[model samples]
Each structure stands twice: as C-alpha cells, then as structure tokens.
Target: MKNVVIAQSGGPTSVINNSLRGAIETFLSSGKIGKIYGARMGILGVLNEELVDITAQDPKQIKLLERTPSAGVIGSCRYKIKSQEDLERIVEVFKAHNVGYFLYCGGEDSMDTANKVSLLARERGLEVICVGIPKTIDNDLGGKLQEDGTFAICDHDPGYGSVARNTAINVLEANEENKASYTSDPVLVIGVMGRKMGFITASARLADPRREMPLLIILPEALSQDDYKSNLEYITEKVNEVLKAHKRCIIVIGEGVNVGDLGILKDSFGHAQFSAAEKSAEQVLANYLNGLDRKDEKGRARSRLVVSGIARYEKPGTRQRREIAYVSEVDLREAYEVGAYAAKLALNGETGYMATIRRIPGEKYQVEYSKIPLNVVANSAREFPKKWISENKVDVTDDFVKWAMPLIGGPLPEFANFKEIMAPKLCRDYIPAGLREQGA
Candidate 1:
C-alpha cells in the first residue's frame, strides 16, 4: 500500500484544516494507501520523527479535523530547514517509513521545503510524490490577473474571502462606532494583516463600492521605508480633506507597512512576521498622529490618534478564518478540492509538482485544479499589482474589485457573535529540552 504523509505549515487560515480534512478523507476512501500520517508541526516533525497516524483515528474525529481551527491538532513550527543536514534528515525519514506520497499545505516557504524534499528523496532511491496545496489569506501566490503583470496562482485564496469580508464589514462597523464617538474621536485607524501585499487592505474597498464614505486604505506595497515622513504628510492631508466633508473617517493600514523603518522582527525566510515587527503600523501611525500638532477649522490645536489592532489570528489563533461558521462554503469547497487534487497528483506518480488552482480561459468564473512544477513557483514571488492601485494610492482600482468580489461569494459565513465553541486540545504537554532547561 502507498503510504501517505501530509504536513501543514506557515500562518493559519480559516479553512486550512479543511484542506487537511480533504487530504485525510481522500486517503480514507482510497484502497491504495495503507496509512495516512500527519507530520507534527510541519516538516520539523518529520526531522524530529514526530508523526501522527490519522488513519487509525476515529472516523467522527477525523471528520471534525476539517472544522478544527489552527495547527493545534498536529501542531506547527516556525523551524526552517536550510542546511544539508536538514535535507538528509528528511530523506532518511521518508526512506525509513516508505513515505511515498507527501502532501504539503502552507504558503511559499512550505512549498519550497516540499519541493526540495521531493528531489532529495529521489536522490536517496525513494520515489516520493510531492504536491503542494496553496493557502494563505494574503492571496499572494501566482494567480492570473489582467495585464498588470503582478498576479498569484490563486484568484482569491481560501482564507482571503473571510478576511476580506471581515475587513470590509469591520470598516463599516468601525464607521458606526466612530460615527457615535465623533464628538471625541474624529479619525479611526485600523491595522490589518498582509505582510508585503495590498490584497487585505484593498478588501476594504468592498465596504464602500460607492466611494461615499470618507475612507483611506494603506498598503505596504504602496509605500517604501523611506517614505514614512511623506506618507504621514500625505495621510494628514487626506484626513483633513475627509474631515472637511464628513465629521469622521476610517483609515486602514497594512501591518507590515514601514516595518523595516520601525525595527521589526523577521522570520527565517527574511519575510517580516507580524509578531516579530517591533511596532505595528497602527502603533506607528497612531504615534505619528499623536506626535504631530494639527489645527482645526478655528486653528485650535488638536492632537490625538484613535487606533486599534484587529489580529487575523484570534483562535487557531487566526481569527474568524476557521470560525467554522464564518468559513465561506465556496472557500471550504475550493480548499478541500485543492487537497483532493494534490492527492490525485501524488497518486498519479507526479513528483515535485505544486497543485495549483487556476481560472479557465473563458469569461466565466470557472476554475480547475492542476499541477505546476514547484521550481517555477519557488523561483517567483508575486506582489500586489501596480496598475491595480490608483495614482493617489488611497484606493484600489475597480479592476481589483471585480477580480476580488467573486471570491467573497456575496457575503461572509454566518456565526453567533458571542457563542463560545471549543475543540478538544490534546493533553500531552511537554516542553522542549532547551525550554525545559530554561524553565520555560
């Protein structure tokens, strides 16, 4: 029987585990696989010999894995493998257990790791089929967009729809809150996730398709580290313009904006991670406004910044993404179908290919899950398109809205605002040797 090995990595999204569930269910229904194993905490688990056999898990429990939030189940790690020893270790593990089919679910870095492992396994005389399932709320993989030349493989990734919905809706809700507090608060600044991409911030446009609201959306891609002063001055002018027309305004900042200038922490991939960034853009923007001395219509000095941060990861620790009830049924189906297609690639003896979803050539919204060489994907990094942005950089063009509107699928998934839900957290708590020594 062909043994299946699957691993998840990178940031958690709402429907990430649904992809895992799809992989597990695909194997469960197949007679060709003997055991389905999950590498604990992504590829790091394999290097550490930590593998969980989901094949033996209860069918009901396996089903719940789809709706479960976070990498809390198999666990996840930020540990990266770059050395020769790392590659050798992965090859040995695959050979040891006959892990012929490997499915990797994560963002770019995870895809790179899976691609490398497939090659290493082949060198070790093991025929391993490796396929990648694309995911990320950032929606920054290589998907097709119009002639802007900057596009990702996904039209709107699984997690992006929910986040876009949340961002747009929150902008509207924050409008209500700010509207009520306008006497004390004139501006509302919100921080959103999207390390180097503008997709998340652009989603804010969905809230105001008519452009009647006095809103400004900021994306990291639209500014540079050195543009901090100019950016602030620019925003200040816009705020004044909005205030002239309306009593209150909403501003959205991408979390990674000016992170380099603010001294932020970076992951092993040299990508700026939100937790590592010393000060968030919200904090910086708020501080900028607070530090400045502005004047009202009567030239009265008013210096204050009303800002708050909304984390994308709240529980799986990625908020609202996997709030199962909040998950877009369309997104869940696409994510699951992506996993199932990855399984088919592995089963068909395809090696070193990333299973990517792409829209068909017609004018319709049809998509087909297919395979692309990981080498091509690993080499290219898709950024936010320039044409998608207006000259003012305050809003995304209508072309972007048309490209993104379909993925949100009309509206967000339904959920009770205060309803409490809990998944079974596994009980085997053990600290790492280094942490244990430090009494962590």
Candidate 2:
C-alpha cells in the first residue's frame, strides 16, 4: 500500500474543507492506499518533513469536515516554489515517507506547483501520482473567454459560487441597512475581494436582478488604470446618477479598482493583497465623494452631491470567501465531488492532470467532472468577458446574469415590506417652523 499526501495552498474558501474531506474519504475507502498524510502548511511542510498523519484521526471528525470551512484543518500557505533544490528536497522527503500519491488543492499557482512536482518526480525515477483540485474564490482559474460570454476548460472554480453567494447576500443585507439609514448615510460604498477580476464584485447584481435597487458595480476591468482622476470622476458621476434618481445609492467596487494608489502589498506568488492595503478602494471612493480634494472658496471640503449626508464605506474582506453561513449548497456539493474525482484519478494512476468541472450546455443546470492537463491550467488566469460588462460600464449585462445565476445554488431569502398606507390628513400641508425660511 502506497501512502498519500494532500496539501492546500493559497487562500481558503467556505467549502474548501469539503474538498479535503472528499479526497481523504476517497483515499481511505480505496483500500489500495496506506496511511494518509496532510502536509502541515502546504509545500513548506513537505520541505520540512512535517506531515500530519490524517489516517489516525477519528472517522467522525473526518466526516465533520464536510461542513467545516476554510483550510484550518490542514493549514495553507502562499509560499511559492522557485528553486530547483526545494523541488529535489520535496521528492526526497516523499521517497523517504513512501508518499506515492500527491494531491494539491489551490488555484492556478498551486496547479503549477503540482505540475512541477509531477515532472520532477518522474525525472528522479520516482512514481508519485500528482493531481490538483481546483480551489479559488476569485474564479480566475482555467478558462478561455468564448464569444458567447461564457468560459471553457473549467466553467468555474470550487470557491467562487460560495463567495458569489456571500456577495449577493451581503448586498441584500446592505440594501436594508441603506434603506434604514439613508437619511444619515445617503451613499454606501462596499468593497469586495477581487484583484484585477470582477467576478465577486459583479455578483452584487444578483441581489436585485430587476434593477430596482440604486446600485453601481465598479469592476476593475471597466476602469482606466493610468488615470485615477478620471476613474474617480467616473465613479462619482455614476454614484450621483443613482443618488439623483433614488436619493440613496450603493456602490460595490472591486478591491483592485484604479481609484488611486492603495499601497497594496504582494504575496510570494506576486498577487496583490488588497485586503492588507493601506487604504481600500471603497474608502478611497467614499472619501473622494465626501470632498477629499474638491473644496469651496473658503478652502472648506465640499459636501456630497445632491445628498444630505456623507458616504459610508464597508469592507467585507476575507469574510466574503470563508463565511460558512453563505456557502452555496451547489458549491458545497461540487467542491466535494471534484476532490473525490481527483483522488480517483490518482488511484487510477493518472498523473500531470488536475480535476475540472465543466458545465453541460442545456436549460437545466448541470455539470460534469473531468480532468485537464496541469500544464494547460498551471498559470492560466481567466479574464472576465468584456462583452458581459454592460454598455453603461457600471453594471454587468443580462447575459452574464443568465450564465452565473444557477451557480449561486438557490433563491436568496426574501424580506417583507409594508406598502404605503396613509391616514386622513390632520391639517393642510405647511412647512415646519425650522425649515420655513430655508426651504418654504
């Protein structure tokens, strides 16, 4: 019996643990595998020879993983393998530990790492079967932008649906808060996690598909990078348009929007950590609207446009990806199945491949599991369809709504409201004593 090792890298999602559980359960039940180990803190754990014996854990706890959220169980890291010596050391450790099967769960960078390990093991005459499980909330994984405004290769990543649902629910809840507090805070700016991609930010539209809400979605792809002034002006213009019509506006902006310099930090993989930035996109936009730069003749900051109160900003940050309460039922199931499929591939001696989810082209929502060569998706980044960005540039098109609606699982919770019922007038309309001179 050959041993199996599983490691997770990069960020975690609400259903990421379900994928871990899926692989573990599959490997254990195969009967062909020996002790299973989880690399403590991803590839760094392998380099340091710190493998946790997962086989010794209680079956009940293992089963509970299906509901558990994030990568807290096995731990994860953003460490990138950039050296030849580190690659050799990983093979040496695997050989000494008798690790014959290696499964890596992460996004594009992790797939590249898995592909490298597979190739190195083969070159060293070691027969370790390596596989990758797709996991990323950004949904910027393998896929080609098709003319139909949909993606190919992999329809969506495991973590995206949950985060997307979280975004939709967040918008719904924020709408209620905005409706209640619009008198004091007429504009609400919400920052969602998405760097250079708008999948999560665009998901906000799912909350009000009828366009009843005064919401503006600011995608990073839709803004100008070289000109932050123009971007700010453009966003302010959009926000005022909504405020003019509805008296209250909600702006959902991507973290990577080119509003201004955020002084964002970078990870080992070279991706920007917008959450750790000195300032957030929403905060910047809010400050701009609140008159951070524009001033009156006396040098006093100008008030917000056509509104009584200032704009307030909120950043959901990592909660958008790891909140257990918002996990989509569809996403949870798919995460598990994709993981189990990867284990099955490894058991069948498949190498240099990653498990993938593909959508079936039909009216009914359906998907099939398959494998794609790791090299094909190793460093691939899917671009959100430009055609899907509405002509106004502040919203996503209906075509995108049709393509993404099913992935979020089921209908969101509906809130009730009382219809306007006015009583008989007590007296003729008259201006208030305080506002008579100013308004009447």
Candidate 3:
C-alpha cells in the first residue's frame, strides 16, 4: 500500500472542500493506498514538513465536508515554487514520508508546480505519481476555444459555477435596492471577483436573461485601458445613457477593469489582489459617474448625471467565492467527481495528468469528466470568447447565458413584487410648505 499526500492551493471556492473530501473518500476505500495525509497550507506545508493525518480524522467529520466551504479543513496558500531547490525539497519530503502518490488541487500555477514536481520525482528515482485536480473561480484554467463555440481541454472550472451563481443572485438583490434608491443614487456600481477574466462579471446577466433590467456589465477585456482617461469617459457616457432612459442603472464591473490606478497588491504568483487595493474598479467608476473626477474650468463640479442622483458602489470581495449559502448543486457534485477522478488516476498509476470537465454539445446541458496533460493546462489561460461579448461591450450575448446557465444548477429564487396601483385624486393639487415658501 503506497501512502498518498493531498494539498490544496490558491483562493478557495464554496465547493473546494468537497474536492478534498472526494479524493479522501476514494483513497480510503482503495486497498492499494496506505496512510492519507493532507499538507497544511498547500505545498508550503510539504516543504515545512507539516502533514495532517487525514486517515485518523473522524469519519463523520469527513462526510460533513460535502457541505463545508473553503479550504479551512486542511488549509491553503499562495506560495509559489520559483526554484529547483524547492522542487527537490518537495520530493525529499515525499520520499521521507513514504508518499508515493501526490494529489494537488488548484488553478494554473499550482498545475505548473505539480508538473514540475512529477518530472523531478522521476528524475530522482522516486516512484511517485502526481495528479492535478482543477479548482479556480476565475474559470481561466482551460485550453483553446473550439469552432463549436466552446472551450477545449476544460469547459469550465469547478469553483466557477458557485461564484457565477453568487454574482447572479447578488445582482438580483442589488436590483431591488437600486430600484428603491435610484431617486437619490441613480447608478450602483458593483465589483466582483475575477482577476483579469470576465467570467464572474458576465454572470450578472443570469439575473436578467430577458434583458429587462437597467444593467451594464464591464469586463476588463472589453475596454482598452491604454488610455485610462478615455476608458473612464467611455464608461461614464454609457452610464449616462442608461440613466437617461431608465433613470436608474446597475453596473457589474470586474475587479480587474482598468478604470484607473487601483494601487493593487500582488500575491506570490504576481496576480493582482484587487480586494487589498487602495482603490477598486467600482470606486473609480463611481467617482467618474458622480463628477468627482471631472471639474469645469471654473473649478465647479461637471457632473456626469443625466438624472439628479449620485453614483454609489459596493464590493463583494472574497465573499463571492466562499459563501456556503450560494453553493451550486452542480458545482459541488462536479468538484467532488473531479477530485475522485484524479485519485482514481493515481490509483491506476497514471501520472502527469489533470482531471477536466468537458461539456457535451447539445440542447440539454451535459458534461463529462476527462483528463488533460498538466503541461497543457499549465501553459494556457482560457479567455472569455470574443463572440460572447456583445457589440456594445456593456453586456454579454445570449450565447454566454445559455452556456453557463446549467452550471449554476437551476433557476434562482424568485422575489415578490407589488402591483403598481395609483390612488384616485379627490383634492386640488397642493404644493409642500418648503417648496411653496421658497417659490410659489
């Protein structure tokens, strides 16, 4: 029986722990596996020689992981492996612990690290099998786009479904608030997670598939930020147009949208930490909309409003990824299956591969779990298809909505609405005391 070691990396999603649970359940039942250990804080834990005995944990607690959100059970980290010594140290640790099977769960950088560790282990004469389990809310970990209007390698990532649902539901709830407060704050700018990709931001459309709401979505890829001033002006112009027509507008903007300098901080992988930034994309856009960024030659405010209200903003931050209440049924199930598949791969002596989800092309939404080379996914980042972006760039196409709808499991909860009934006027028109005293 060969001992197995599992580690989770990068930002966690609502269903990330289910992947851990899936792998553990698969490994425990396998007679070919020995001791099961979880590396604390991802690969850093392996380097620091801190491994938790997953096999010794309570069985009830193990089964409860299906509902557990995030990576708090074991832990996770953003520590990058930048040197050969680090890889060598990882192999040394595995050899010392008699760990013959290594299962890693993360996004692109983690996959790259797993690929490197697998090669080095073989070179060092260690009979170790390393497999990658895909986990990212960004939905950027996939191959090239196919002619059929779907991406290859991986269709969508495990964490993405839940985040997409979160974005959609948040937009739905925000719409009610915007409707109530539009008289004072005509524009509401919402910032959602998605480092550079537009997938999470695009999910806002799911709340209004009929396109009846006064909603605008801004993807980082949609706007050319070479000139930040023009970008802000363009967004301001678009918001005013919506304000002019609807008198109220809700804008869902990706955190990576380059409205202006956000003073962003980066993680160990050099990815921007938008939540930790001095400014946010929504804050910058709100300032532009409220006329704070634009001043007349006389130093007076040159407001961008087509209506009589200021623009407000809100950021969901990390909440978009780890909210247990917003977890998608399909996302949780697929996350578990992907982890189980990776474990099965190791049990079958498969190496240098990562488990992926590929959508079956049809009217009825379906997906199949398959394998792709770790090196392939490691070297590529899937871009939101250009065809999916609407021509105005303020919205996504129905094609995108159709493709992502099933992953969110099912339709969202419907809210109540009051009928617009007006009371009959029986008295003469009268002005309020303040207005009558000031003018009439």
Candidate 4:
C-alpha cells in the first residue's frame, strides 16, 4: 500500500480546511493510496515522527474539517525548515511510515521546503513526490501581467475575499460609528491589512463602490517618504472640510500605510499583517490632527475622533478569518479545488510545483489550475494592481470591483451565530517519572 502524508503550515485561513478535505477525499477515493496520515503540527511533527494515521478513523472526519477553524486541529507553525538537519529528519519519518507521496499545504515558504524535499528524495531514490497548495490571506503568491495588469493567478486568493467582506462591512459599520460619533470625534480613521502588497488594503474600496465615502487609504508602497506627511495633511484638511458640512468623516488607512509614527506587524515571511499592537495609524493621525500647528487658515481648533483597524492580527485576528458567515462561497469552492489539484500533482509523478490559481480573461469569472515552478513562486510577490487604485490610491477602481465582486459570490456564508470555539490544551495533572516513562 502506498501510504500518503499530508500537512499544513504558516498562518491559517477560513478555507484552509477545505483544502485539507480536498486532499483527504482524493486519497481515500483512489486505490493507489492506502492509509492517509497527517503530521500533527506540520514539518516539525514530521521531524518528531509524531504522525497521526487519520485514515484509521471514520472518513467523516473530513466533514468536521470543513467546519473546523484555525490551525489547532493538525496545527501549523512558523518554524522555518531551512537546514540539512531538518531535511534528514523528514527523510527518516517518510521512510519509517513508507510514505510514497508527501502533500504540503501552505504559502511560498512551505512550497520551497517541499521543493527541497523533492530534490533530496530523488537523490536518495525515494519514489515520493511533493506538491504545494497556496493558502495565504495576504495573496502574496503568484504574479500579474505588467501589460494588462491582471493577475496570472486567480483574481483573488480564497482567504482574501472573506477578509475583504469583513473589511468592507467593517468600514460600512464604522461609517455608522464615525457619523454618529463625529460630533465628539470629528475624524474617524481605520487601519487595514497589507504590508508590502496592497491586496487587503485595496479591498476597503469595496465598502463604498461609488467613491462617496471620505476614505483615505495609505500603503507602504503608495508613496515615497517625502510625500507621506503631505498626504496626511491633505487627508486632515479633507476631514476638516467634511466636518464643516457634517459632524464627522470616515477615513480608511491601510495597516501598511506610513502614518509617520505608527507600528506594523511582520509575519514569518517578513510581510506585514498590519496588526497594531504598539500604536495604530488611526491614533497617530488623531494625535496629529489634535496637535495642529500654531496657526491655521481659519484658526479653528482641531478636534479628535475615533481610530481602529478592522482586521489586525495583534488582537486575536482569527475571528475575522474563521467565522463561516463572512466566507465567500466562490472562495470556498476554489480553495477545495486547489487542494484537490495539489493531491493530484503528488500522485502524478510531479514535484516542486504549486497548485496555482490562474484567472481566465473574459466575461465569466473563470480560473484554470496550472503548475508553476516553486522557486519562481518563492521569489515573486503579487501586489494590488496599480491601475486598480484610483488617483488617490486609497480606493480601488470600478475595474477592481468587477474583478473582485465575482470572486466573493453573491450569497452570504451560513455560519452559526453563537459560534463554536476552541481553547488551548490544559494539563490536568502531572504524572510521576515512572508513569511518564511508561507513556502514561
């Protein structure tokens, strides 16, 4: 029997489980494969030889996976597998389990690891093949054409749409809060997702498709250092102008935006998650507006307002990604398909390839699955389309809406309102040394 091993790593996504389900379903339905095993917590588990034979349990566990949220089930890690020692450890585990196919699910870094394993396996004459499934909310994988500016990978990634909806609605709801509280807090500023790539940052435009909202988006790459302060000043002036007519104005700031003194979060890949643990860009802007210069055109005292980031990772950002209600059905299907593709590649004697989502040009929002060299994917970075951004660079253009609106689908996701939850493992009691040695 050709035993198969599957694992996931990096940050978790709303549909990460769907990909896992796809791979399990593929392996179970195929005769070439036998018992399916999962590394309890990704490559680290593989190195530790703590393999869980999931196939021994009822296959219905796959169903639970679809609903299961976060990386807690099989677990995931940020530990980079870059050394020869790590590679040696993986070979021993795969040999121990008679694993013929190794299916990995994660972003570019994970893919690179998978590629290395494939090379080592071939050198050692092991028959196993390795394949990667792309999963990141940042959507930093894949590339777009510099010509038409459309992404080569599917328009948006699976995880991004849900967060996009969250940001959109969060901005919409914040509008209510901003408008209502603007009298006391005249300026409403929000931080968004996007460190280097503006994918998450640009999605804020979807909140107000008409560009009617007084939204100001800032991204790391939006401008050079010299123009950043001028941009903030422009936004403050606009906030004041809007305040003249109404009590408050809604301001949207990207987490990656250079709000002078605000801080940002960098993931394992060094890409920013835009989480504000230190201080938010919104707070920075609020402080700036509050402490205006000695003199002004009208000599009106600046007013303070509210500041928040709708989807920052610093403060338990899982709720925004895991909640099923906010997930896009379109994304759900694509995620599953991508996972299935990864499994198929593992079976087809193909290795060192990522199951890439590619957008088909034309009317219907269609995608074709193809293989890209993992090395290419590792080095490349995808950003929000420049043309997609309007002149202000805060909002996405109508074309951006047309491309993204379809990816999210029309129907809202059906998630239980009360919400099922998970907690950390608790140690009930300590066992004696003798008991512990005996595997108690």
> For this target, which candidate reaches the highest lDDT against the unseen true structure?
2
Tens-digit lDDT track of model 4 for 21-84:
8888887787779878888888888988888887887767778877676667788876677689
Cα RMSD, each candidate: 13.1, 1.6, 2.1, 14.8
TM-score sort, best first: 2, 3, 1, 4
lDDT against the true structure, each candidate: 0.74, 0.92, 0.91, 0.70
In angstroms, give how far residue 422 of model 2 lies from its true place: 2.2
lDDT of 3 at 331: 98
- Candidate 2 per-residue C-alpha lDDT over 1-440 given as tens digits, one digit per residue, 9 for 90 to 100: 89999999999999999999899999988999999999999998999999999999999989998888888888999999999999999999999999999999999999999999999999999999999999999999978766544478789999999999999999999999999999779999999998999999899999999999999998999989899999998888888889889999999999999988999999998999998999999999998999968788898778656776789999987878888998899999999999999999999999999999988776778899999999999999999888889888899988778888898998998987777798989999987796556443
Displacement of the residue 148 alpha carbon in candidate 3, Å: 2.4
lDDT tens string, model 3, 131-244? 999999999999767877568989999999999999999999999999999878888999999988999999999999999899999998898857878888888888889987
| Candidate 4 to truth, TM | 0.83
Error of 2 at 172 (Å): 0.7
* Top candidate when judged by TM-score against the true structure: 2
How far in Å is the alpha carbon of 364 misplaced in model 4?
A: 1.7
What lDDT is reached at residue 248 by model 3? 96
For candidate 4, give the lDDT: 0.70
The residue pairs that clash in candidate 4, if any, are 154-357
Quote the positional error of residue 263 for candidate 2 in Å.
Answer: 0.8
